[model samples]
Every structure is written in C-alpha cells, then in structure tokens.
Target: MATVVPPDLELFLTGWLRSNITDVDGLQVGHRTPDGYDGSYPLIVVRDDGGAQSADRVVFDRSVGVNVCGWTRNSPKDCRDLAARVYGLLTGEPDILVGFAEGSSVCAVVPDGCNGPYPVTEDAPYCRYYMTVEYSAAGIRQS
Candidate 1:
C-alpha cells in the first residue's frame, strides 16, 4: 500500500529561514538536523529584546554559528533601536530594507539602524527567539 507523502520538509524550512532572515546582511540560513521538528535554528547573536520560545520571549546567547541572527526590541519609542544595533555592526547608520515573505511592503528602519527620518515597523519579524535557536549542537547530545 502506498501512503500520501508530504512535500520536502527541509526545502520548506530552508525557504522559511531565508525569508525570515531577509533583514540581516550577508546572512543565509541552513539546516543540518538528522531528524527533529523541522530541523533548523537561526544563527546566534547578542540581543537585549526577546519574546516567546520562537514567536514570543527570546534572548541573545552571544554564541552561535552560521545562521540568522534574531531581531532586537530596544526602546519603546521605536523598535528600530534593536535592529539599529544589528545593522549598526555593518553601517554607521544602516537604512536596511527588511522584507517579509520575500517581498511584502518591505519595512524600513526607524531611526537607529538606518538614517530614516521616521519609519514604521521593523524590517523582519522579531527574531530574538529565532536567533537563539541557531547554535553549535555538534558537541551536544540529541536526547
């Protein structure tokens, strides 16, 4: 008997990572899990804002490998403060264009990461939690 087969999970995950990390520069997501839930974890980077395990509370670990560094949420006045920190590493005043789902009203920097006078929303989804997952499990146990 032949059972229904779902689409390639790896491909889907890969695509998801790429789409999510669009805000980061020169950053690309990858997967190397043998078997697990989706099998992926964006890169790790120092962060101050976070929410959920993934779509919620998140924090930075200052340790990760090649992956998508999560987003930041510093200062209530604007969300770009965190992004500004991330992009700041690249540009003195980064005016990044973070596009959601490849290209969807690509958000712009507020006034920290970029040289924007007054923008709205962060470029990418709040990735503080997503970035926390990206780590080097090569030395850790699976179970």
Candidate 2:
C-alpha cells in the first residue's frame, strides 16, 4: 500500500520567502526564532502551526506563522513594512507551488486567512510583527 506524506511547510516557506523577497538585502529568515537572537536586524521567522490531513491522505491543510522583527530603537514602520510585503506575496497569488525533498512537492498553496503584523512586547529589544496563513497542499504518496 502507498501512503501520502505531507511537505514541511515551515522549511518550504522559509526558503520560499528568502529566495523570492529580494527587496530586503541581508534579511534573515529561518524556521525558528532563537532566544536572544542578536545576529541581525530585520529578521523573519517561519513556524509550523500544524494542520490536518484528508482521510484519503492525498491532501493536507497546513497553517504557518510568519514573524517579522526589527531593531527596537528603530521605528516600528520597518517591521510593519516587511510584514506587509510578506502578506502581499502570500495572499496576492492564486496558487503557489512549493517543492520539497526528493521529487515531492506541494502542488498548490491557497491562502485561507491572515492575521497581524502586531507588536511583540516580550522581545523588548526588538519590534516584532506576526502573521499567520493557511495553505492547502497536495502531498506525495509513497509505497
């Protein structure tokens, strides 16, 4: 019997945004936002918010969280601007193709919903904005 395997949304989105968004040079993007990450300003973090697989296992509905962080001393506008760019890219397109390991790929990505480029008070040293997006993906089947 064959089984369907879902693509890693976090990794795909991280790489996708990093390669596609060329406006911001030196922007750091990753799957996780480390504790006290002091490497650079204007960073983007991608997180897997988890999702559901269809009963037939051929489709997956996934949610991803994207965060934009800027230096605290700087105006929050920078963080907001980056967040807006990400949001536009994700939602503006009708369908996005995300390729993963071995020949496996997400055939389509549909934006279900989006929330906030809001502030993060916890990370006091940096201004942060968070956004969430839902994706409908076609998984790969393997025996």
Which numbered prediction scores highest in TM-score against the true structure? Answer: 2
lDDT of 1 at 72: 39
TM-score quality measure for candidate 2: 0.81
lDDT of 1: 0.30
TM per prediction: 0.24, 0.81
lDDT of 1 by residue, 4-38 (tens): 22222234335544554476444444454123322
- Which ranges in model 1 have alpha carbons more than 4 Å from their true place? 33-143
lDDT score, residue 28, model 2?
87
lDDT of 2 by residue, 1-143 (tens): 88788877777777788877777867888987778776356789998777888887788887778888876636677778888888776654435334343333554455445666566667466778888877777786689
- Candidate 2, residue 11: Cα displacement in angstroms equals 1.5
Looking at model 2, the pairs that clash are none
lDDT of 2: 0.72
